[model samples]
Target chain A: MECLSDVGFSGATVGVVAKRAGVSRGAAQHHFRTREDLLTAALLHMSENRLAELRRRAADLPDGAARTGAVVEMLIDAYTGPEFSAALQLWAAAANDPRLRSQVIPLEEHVGREAHRAAVDLLGADETAPGVREAVQATLDLARGLGLASLLTDDEPRRRRVVGQWTRMLEETLR
Target chain B: MECLSDVGFSGATVGVVAKRAGVSRGAAQHHFRTREDLLTAALLHMSENRLAELRRRAADLPDGAARTGAVVEMLIDAYTGPEFSAALQLWAAAANDPRLRSQVIPLEEHVGREAHRAAVDLLGADETAPGVREAVQATLDLARGLGLASLLTDDEPRRRRVVGQWTRMLEETLR
Candidate 1:
């Protein structure tokens, strides 16, 4: 993440990360078999961290709606927060690199499934409510896109407004 | 895009892009006053290309539903198309780099509005149709998330299937 701050994704290098971590090339290799492995590890580590944090943030909330709201807030925070920029870097790499995709996709799917389940459970949505399901899926989709778009600019007020819009959508859907 | 392909956005330099473009550094500077300017030009160029193709793809559809569905399909194609990955590299750069964000955000918003408006016009959706508007926005949002998620894997069939699911949702929503 530190290295990403200076050079961004296209500029980040394994050598630079290794040097920054104060580990030798061989040591880094032992931990990550390849450059893709190294990046995947770093990304997964961050995802796990953020996921855990999201759960923690939502823990105190009452039910699925509140939990969903909490999760939406978490998404907004994750995107605009300090840890977000590195994710942007990882995404950039994954966009074109097939090798990186192998490592990154499963994690995302896992996260997507988890988030979807949370939304489903929270709304008491049944298998038959395809419309609700679509809405939930769409909410997740828009949040991700908006998150990336938000990073393109540092508009705090806009970010806040977007988050509010997201929250409103969730509420309206559930109601 | 060439620079992104060659260097994957990690180590690409303005000097390198100029060299690859077969232009003198001064000449490159003359066209793009800064690296960000070059990136902005590249993004705009690609967005235009993608939008034009989308317009053509959706033009032949028989009705509003079909047109909307076509737009979703076009979105999937535009996003997963070869140009998209390259654009993503710069997008990632912009997400983390404030200097780059200034250029990236406006372009994103422009393209987003274009897509949304197309969907609205095709659906004949008015502001009062919160459900329809939300549905349109939701589908676009999910397609984005899925597209980004799809980039991390080599499952072409599954990616298409996932996009197909989204297209299906649009059909159902319109119905």
Candidate 2:
């Protein structure tokens, strides 16, 4: 994961990952045959880690108005971390690689659905209500866009303001 | 741009681009000294095309309540096209390449600010009002996130639904 985040997909070769893991190339290959296999396994592991992190953060969220802010912040944090960075590398690679895209698309959908469910639960949103489900999805999308912005620059101050504003908007819409 | 969109940044070599453009390699290099120069030029072209496209669509938008949905659709359209696909390739490449990162970051910021300003103008939104500016920013972010989702799969159905929901929210917020 660190290899993917630090050097990107193309640069994270088997030998490099193996060396970084303090294992011989042959030993690494013994476990995961191809780079695709290794990457798929790593991404699956990262997805689980992200969900676990979301659940852990959900436990500490405060009640009422404060919960919206915390939930938005937590969601934003999920997208801005190294895990997202690694996933982004793989996503870019997969965009042009049909085989990798085939493997990645399902995993991404599963993770996305899980994240959306987690957000809906954390916000105590009733999806049966008109626009509530889309509001939650929009919140997640906004977080991801903020993450994309953060990839190139330190967009923290603007991001904080945006989050604050979205939290307010979400509070009203979800209500 | 098509080359980048179709094959990604690494595969869109000078040779491939030249071949696609029906220009000699010498002529291509004469215009762009390096791959970075070629990509930078292409990106600038793409950005201008996007903004011009936005303005053209903006002129056709309706008045009053219906405008919000049209604006949301316009913004979403801005991000889901070939220009965005080419830009995504560059963004992923720039994330790991410092030199490319420096060039792409400023260009992206400029484009983002332009898009935000355009959205504010189109929505007739008041930035002086509390949360208005952030609302606009979040709208753009949501559009971008929708774009990201479209990259891997045919997310049109869900994207349309989310846009519909967001249009309602924006109409309420801006009102």
Candidate 3:
């Protein structure tokens, strides 16, 4: 996570990752024979780590706008972290590389689907209701845009304001 | 643009790009001088090309949801092309390379600010109003997320559904 996110996928050499993990190169090679093997393992590890965090965040929350706000907050925080950077690197790299694309597509697909399910569960929002599903997606989607903006500029204040505004609108529309 | 987007920033060799363009390596080097020079020039060309399309798409339309849908269509179309691929390349590369970051930051900043302005104008929505600003931002943000999803999956059916639903909500909220 640290290597991939901090330096990007292309920069995440086995040498760098092994050094970061405080392991010998030989040991690292023994565990993961190739770059693809290492990246797949890293991504799976990220998913597991994120799942644990989501479960923790999902614990005990009031329903309605309050719950929705918490879910959005969790999403915003996640996107602002190193994990997002790593996923972005994969997305960009996979755009052209069929080899990487083959590896990343399934990883991303499973993660994206699960995250959507988690968001609905955390918010206790009914996806079957009229317009509710789109509102749910809008919340996550807006968070992504705000997150990308943060990478280039320190627009946290604006991001927070937008999130607040969006949450309110979501409640009014969905409720 | 194809060379960079299809091969990535690191993989975009002068030899490959020149060969792809049916030009001699010597001639390509003479025109671009360096990889940075070539990438920057390519990015500028993409920006100009996109600006023209945005302007054309911003043409006269009925205010309210109709206008909102049109703008979203423009955004979706933009993402379904080479420009988005190139932009993604810059974003991924800029995360680590300070030199590329410096060149891209200003380019992205200008494009983002203008795109937001154009969106608000095209929608004829009052940015100073209660949730109008956030609605505008949300529209663009959501489109971006949908665009990213499209890169990996053939989710056109879901994308269309989301756009239609988002347009209705945005219409009601902005109005």
Candidate 4:
């Protein structure tokens, strides 16, 4: 997944993936036969790993402030990091390759919906509430944009401010 | 830019780009000596073209209804299309390569800020208003998320619905 995100889909060959993992090609091929299989497995692994991380982080909420902080942090770590990077590669690749598209689109959408639901829960907000869903989506979307920005330029402080301010904005909007 | 977005940094070699553009390798290299230079030039060209299109689209937005509709359309087109895809490529590519990061980060941020300002104007919103900046930012951010989803799947109807709903929400907030 990291390799795919780093070099993109066309470059994430089986041999490259194996070499990046510090394993022989034969060892890698033993588990996954083709680049597609390897990449698909990696994408799934990334999504599941992120979901677990979100749950663990949301395990103990200290207060409203801490909860908000946790939510923002999870949003950044989940969508703006390697998970998103890999997804970007897959999304672009899937556009051209129908086989991969059929496999990737649903999985990618599922991850997005799952993240949305988790965010709603973390905020202790009802998705059905008036304007609540849009507000929540807005927060995540803003975080994504900030996260994308960070990828271009590791401006941690600016992204921090944007996400923090966005969290507060959502609080008021939801209220 | 399309090549980078489609195949990513590593796959968007000079040869691939030249082929994609239907130009000779000599012709392509005459303009950009290296892959990084080619991609950077392409990225800038994409941004400039989008800005021009935005300006042209924003030319005669009608009253409240048409204006909101136009804003939503512009938001969707600007972010969800190839422009964002290429930007996504540069973004992911810039993550580890500091040289690429340095080249891309500023360009990405500048494009972002320009887009934000244009969005504000397109929406007829006041950037100086209280919470207005964040509100505008959120609107663009939500559109971006919707756009990203569209790239993975042909969720045009759903994305259209989200953008329309968010536009209404922003109308209430901005007013």
Per-residue C-alpha lDDT of model 2 across residues A79-124, encoded as one tens digit per residue: 8867777888888888888998999999889889898989998899
- Candidate 3 to truth, TM: 0.91
Chain B vs. true chain B: TM-score for each candidate? Answer: 0.82, 0.95, 0.86, 0.90
Ranking by lDDT: 2, 3, 4, 1
Candidate 1 wrongly placed segments (more than 4 Å): A10-39, A64-80, A94-139, A154-175, B10-30, B33-35, B131-135, B155-175
TM-score of chain A of 3: 0.90
DockQ of 1: 0.35
Better of 1 and 3 by lDDT: 3
State the lDDT of candidate 4 residue by residue for B52-101, as single tens digits.
78878777778776687678778777888776777766666676577887
Across A16-124, the per-residue lDDT of candidate 3 in tens digits comes to: 9999999988899999998777887788788768867987868776665688787788877777656776777878877887887898888877877787787777777
lDDT for each of the candidates?
Answer: 0.65, 0.87, 0.76, 0.73
Name the best candidate (by DockQ): 2
lDDT of 3 at A130: 89
Question: How would you class the docking of model 4?
Answer: acceptable
Candidate 1 per-residue lDDT over residues B34-99, each given as its tens digit: 888886787788777767766675556667556655667666666664566677777777665777
| TM-scores, one per candidate | 0.73, 0.97, 0.91, 0.83
Q: What DockQ, between 0 and 1, does each candidate earn?
A: 0.35, 0.75, 0.63, 0.42
State the DockQ, from 0 to 1, for candidate 2. Answer: 0.75
Could you give the interface RMSD of candidate 1 in angstroms?
Answer: 3.9
Task: Place model 3 in a CAPRI quality band.
Answer: medium
lDDT of 3 at B154: 78
